[model samples]
Target: MVKHIWDSDRAAKLPKGVEELVYRSNLIGSDRTVCNWGGGNTSMKTTEKDFRGREIEVMWVKGSGSDLATMKTHNFTGLKLDDIRPLIKRDQMPDEEMVDYLSHCMIDSKHPRPSIETLLHAFLPYKHVDHTHPDAIISICCADNGKQIAEDIYGNRFVWVPYVRPGFTLSKMIAEGVANNPHAELVLMEKHGLVTWGETSETCYQKTISIIQEAEQYVNDRINQHEVFGGKRYQPLPEDKRKQILAGIMPVIRGAVSEEKKMILSYDDHDDVLEFVNSVQAPALSQIGAACPDHLVHTKRVPLYIDWNPETQDVHKLADLIKSGVETFTSEYQAYFTRNQQDGDQIFESAPRVILIPGIGMVNTGKSYAMSKVSGALYRRAIAVMKGATALGQFVSLHENESYHVEYWPLELYKLTLAPPEAEFSRKVALITGGAGGIG
Candidate 1:
């Protein structure tokens, strides 16, 4: 496993209260072996010294939307420790209301809001908390008999919490569990993630690596490699054919973005995408599953399968096919919503974010082509992982009821609104050697 070390000298130069920040940043950076693509967060707590020498202990957690691998000093925010304590004590806070707390209770008052999970981090018993959706861990958790697998891999060192939306409720559960077993160092959130903490950041970070590596090895030994497969390849579409596909998809993509934002559309056109479009497994795109429950907001539950090719110079035919696919996807979504309705509330948008074309590449619906590409790229990754896990055994994610709770959860939507207009890529490039493997 890889061991990561942060800039100890640079961390020491920061204000006295930043010990947790230094620890968390390095721990996250080191544990990138499992999580990549900005999938996790970490936090630490200490008393902030005021100019008058009065001390106020605050939670310095990863800021919303920041990548853990390259997190910097400023990405950590000081949240009022007192405010979070009471909410956790109550063990309940409405989803949207929790987001409001994060937005309103700022230490500097003018700085960016803390992460949405800041409350969860603050409520934990440890001075430092690390959370990640490691690929290896998630892969195992998404399979049948995951509990047994986890027990065999992590043993009694970790505690498992069933899938819950990440917020006050999840924090409450963790708080209660910790109260029962105060010695627990790890919390394995079923179908969600792995949480590790320590007195110092390095201990928590190294433990994260060790756990994921163990899981990866266990999976390798148990699962047959031949059952795992990459996507299939397809023949290239001619110019007119490609243009027809774009014409059918562009309108849907345009309607999704706000009018004020400049929008551009692009396609994967990569070897993998092209191959998958024509492969025998193409029909599996719309199978009954999601990459992860959280991903439903961006990619939707499943993609629309476009199978009928536009006839030679038949514009109306292309339009008909597109409309048909849209209608089918909408019908399926309505069915899902009806079948999974918790209350009498109405459903959200019926449109799918990605459209899969047989014998061609896929189109991602987004405000801009870049954003769409990110969504599609993430979708492909999820599909690959799901397919890989199925090779070992039956693949599963959180149930639809659980998926719906998060899909309709107000905090998630609010978090989306709080994000900057366009997705921002990190300026720093992080590469960790010999850290953990496959959770992130």
Candidate 2:
């Protein structure tokens, strides 16, 4: 279960409002169990002076593409609440128009872009609001019987919202749900995450933690009763053997997947990774789709799983198998893109960001070390979500069409443009022999 780390003494040191909101966001985001990196957002509404020196209500929200764990005051965008709240009455707002309208509401043009869910935070009548994609909450949200499970767990304290892509419509639906159920304390967006609010930042943060704890306890109680991944079908090889095998086959796998662009590879053989990859269910589970929509941007819609018998197959045979797997994955990915392509959509590389190898572990591919490491970490979280959901009931992943839309969403892709252009050595590895002398 996620720990309750809120410190009253420490919180007392910070001034209330956005300062308190940042403290709460950092506390929740520090725990990966509470939310994936860059996957959740927090906000607070406060009265602040405008350019005209008049006090005006403003909503300070986490900036787009910012990680909650490391954000500061400057990382949040403050928008005039009066300008934003009126939009709740609109029957519908196109995502593009909504984004444009939001820009117009910013208190300062220099603040970063407001999060995609800024409207949700503004529409809800609360001083403090938090929306997080906790693993435990998502496990219940991603199960086939998720709605029923939610009803059993929280009764009427939380409102269940059917799956809706994040934007104006979802924000409206959630507002209406809460308006109808005035006493609801939390909002659960199906196949999405949790939203909690309170009159104070501390109240909102504690409520978020308490709700996730309940969900975690519920999953933990039932997980052991069910066979894990239908009982692991294979055991990991010895550490020395696993590393030797990877050393020989890593280059081969890398070469095959880097046809479009060079990629750095990150390998993980953690116990949990081995447990999943060696299971009878890994291939099928990995192919279904991402457990959460947030994972699609980093890990892709699905990973490429290489079926290899570690005990019976040598490194050469494993290399051959990776080659075949890459060929098949590339073709299937291309087909997925062809089927889902829209007028303005540009196809991403057909290669998979993640690859699963039985008796070995998982390998993530990216343009840099940090990127590859993040992919591996997020995929590990997906593994955890899969385990918990399957234990509770049938695990339900995002549909292929929905997955494609998120993976190629224009707004999401825009985040990449914010980074500086790559340098000459952006993806190259260099060994500097004089590093100790500072010259390197």
Candidate 3:
């Protein structure tokens, strides 16, 4: 996490509300680049008093689709400050309507709708707000020991809240939590991510960076330095065996790819491909999950670990592992869900999308090769971050029940829901699997 500040060229000419826009947008966009895809938000509040002589009557906030890493002033949609203040004080509101109401309060008349979490940003009693699905922070939260670790690392400086749907209900939960822990400088939402704020844009941005850096450093110190496990050192295979191995993998993956994504199948797998595959951490890399709530649908709670069997040159054996991995995972997931579930909640799938085989490295087996591949890549980054988070102290994340609530929440269900009527068949497509080099 970098404590972002306005560049000298821009800060030198701070244009009132523009300063908040520049700093807050950059702060959020930067974090979004590393971990989230359509998942995070940020904001800044300006009271009517702050603009004493000016006609500007609203607070600026991040807009939907704006990447914090490269957000410009136009990326911020402004909202009436007075309108937001009163809503946060209210007891309830529908989630979807909240965005519409917030939109009506936009500070900039021509800008697109602001981020859906705008109200949640408003609920925070600070001038600047920052949130992200940081890979390192989230990896720790997904682990079995997440809660204890978080308590050990953050201590009193942070307030930890259970995972909630990211809208009115979530905002209400946070507002109440903040009221209870008024002194807390930071808030950590379990199975989600971190939130930090301050009196100024710089203060809020710097605080967020500093806190994340602290967690990163803490994790780094505890990383296992040795490359070899027990007496084994990972080594590459002979060129022919490698080619043969690739050949087998290519066919299965090609068989699973859709026509629109067929171009991806033609990509060649060579030593460079092998090298990339080999670089993935296998045995100890099983800890990564979604950096926040949204990522869970893609990566799941844990990755499957498989080791090479010398007697098994058969690809069917490998396929069996993939199938069995899903069964085993589903069983374990159900067990975890059943043990932690609240009233009326149902358990989800036991299938595994990403698998890590010791010597063979990582294999993605999702609905398509690309989707599965992305999941694998995500896990690698997450694991690296978790290793770093450990040095900060023990990692803490959402309790099991909290994770269940978010995973099964109606909002999340909307995403998991299938296409309606005949659209379901259209949503499905052909699957191609294999490399141009005659291996998959």
Candidate 4:
């Protein structure tokens, strides 16, 4: 179960309103079980003075590209609530037009762009709102019988929203759902995440924590009752042997996938990772696609799984297998792009972000060490989600077309452009041969 870590004394030090919202956001985001890095958003509706010194209702939301755990006052974008609230009344709004419309709603032109789900926060009739992709909740959300499980867990306390890509339409649907169900205390987006709100920040934060704990307990209870991931099929090799194998194979796998852009590779052999990769269901489950939409941008639609026999195959054989697997993955990815491409849509890199080796571990690739680590962490969460969902029933991933759309979504892609330009040695690894006197 996810522990409730709210500290009243800590929260009391901060001002009430936006600062409290940031504190609440950080608390929720601090736990990977509650939300993955940059996977969730929070908002607070407060009255603020405009340029004319006249107070107007403003919605302060987590900005685009900002992570909840590390964000501050400047990381939030403030917008006039009166301006964006009216958007909820529209019958339909296109994605492009919605972006344009939201830019005009900013309370200060200098503030960063509001989150893509700003409208969802604005439309809800609450002062504090939180939308998080909690692993416990997502486990239930991604199951084939997700809706029925959710109902069993929470009954009608939370409103169940069918899968809808996050945008104007989804925002509107959530608002209508809340409006229609006055008794509902929370909103659960199918195959997505959980949404909670309150008149006070503490109330809001506590509600989010309590609900997740309930779901976590439910999943834990059920998971303990069954053989997870259909019980492990292969045993992990000794630690020394695993490391030796990784040292030999990392470069070959890295070189194979880095044809277009150089990449840094990070390896993981945690008990969970080893358990999943060595499981009977690893190949079928890993190929199904991402467990959540937020994971798409970081981990890609699906990870490439190398079908090599660890005991029978040498590093040379594994290298050849990596080449063959990557080729197949690239071809499949290109076909996916072709099938889902729109007029203005451009394809992202065809290389897979994650690779799983049976009886070995998982390898995550990115432009830098930090990014590679993040990819590994997120995929680990995906593994956890898959385990829980499958333990409950068959795990269901996001649709292929939906995965393509998210991978190419302009708004999602825009976050990548927000980072500062990489340094000269950005993607290059360096070694200091002589630590005591390197210059000598």
Best-matching candidate per lDDT: 2
lDDT tens readout by residue for model 2, 1-440: 79888999999999876788889999989998888978899999999999989999999999998888988888999999999988988999998999999999999999999998999999999999999999889999989998888888999888889998899999999999999996699999998899999888889988999999999989988887888888887889999998998889888988998888888889999998999999989989888889888889889889999889887888898999999998899999899999999998887777889999999999999889888998998998899888899988889988999998888988788767766787898767688688788576
lDDT of 4: 0.89
**TM-score, each model?**
0.74, 0.97, 0.67, 0.97
Per-residue lDDT tens digits for candidate 3, residues 1-440, read: 44454465665577767565676566455554234654566777665433346554466777765556676888777787777778866677886678668767765568867765777787777777877766656645554566667777787767777766678877877777787885787777776777888887777767877777776655545554533112243455665665666577646543432222331222223332333334434344344343455656566666666555523445667656555555666678778777877787766544555555434555554544455665655555554444444433343444455556566765455533432333333324556766555675
lDDT of 1: 0.66
- The TM-score that candidate 4 achieves is 0.97
lDDT by residue for model 1 (1-440), tens: 33445556765566655655655565565454455444667887777765577787777887766666676777778887876787765746886687777765567765556776777688786877878776667767677777777778777667778877787788888767766775576777777777778777656666777777787777766545643333344456775777676776567544443233434445666665665566655566446556565577777766777765433435456556767777777778888888887664558667667777755577776655555775687667565556546655676776667777667765556556665665463221247766776753
Which 10 residues in a row give candidate 1 its minimum summed lDDT?
Answer: 254-263
Off by over 4 Å in 1: 1-39, 50-52, 69-74, 86-88, 96-105, 178-183, 221-224, 229-264, 269-282, 307-323, 334-349, 358-361, 420-440
Each model's lDDT: 0.66, 0.90, 0.60, 0.89
**Model 4: residue 15 alpha-carbon error in angstroms:** 1.5
In order of lDDT, best first, we have 2, 4, 1, 3
Error of 2 at 416 (Å): 1.9
Where does model 2 exceed 4 Å of error? 432-440
* Candidate 1's TM-score: 0.74
For candidate 1, give the lDDT of residue 235: 56
- Model 4 misplacement above 4 A: 432-440
Q: Is candidate 2 or candidate 3 better by TM-score?
A: 2
lDDT of 4 at 242: 88
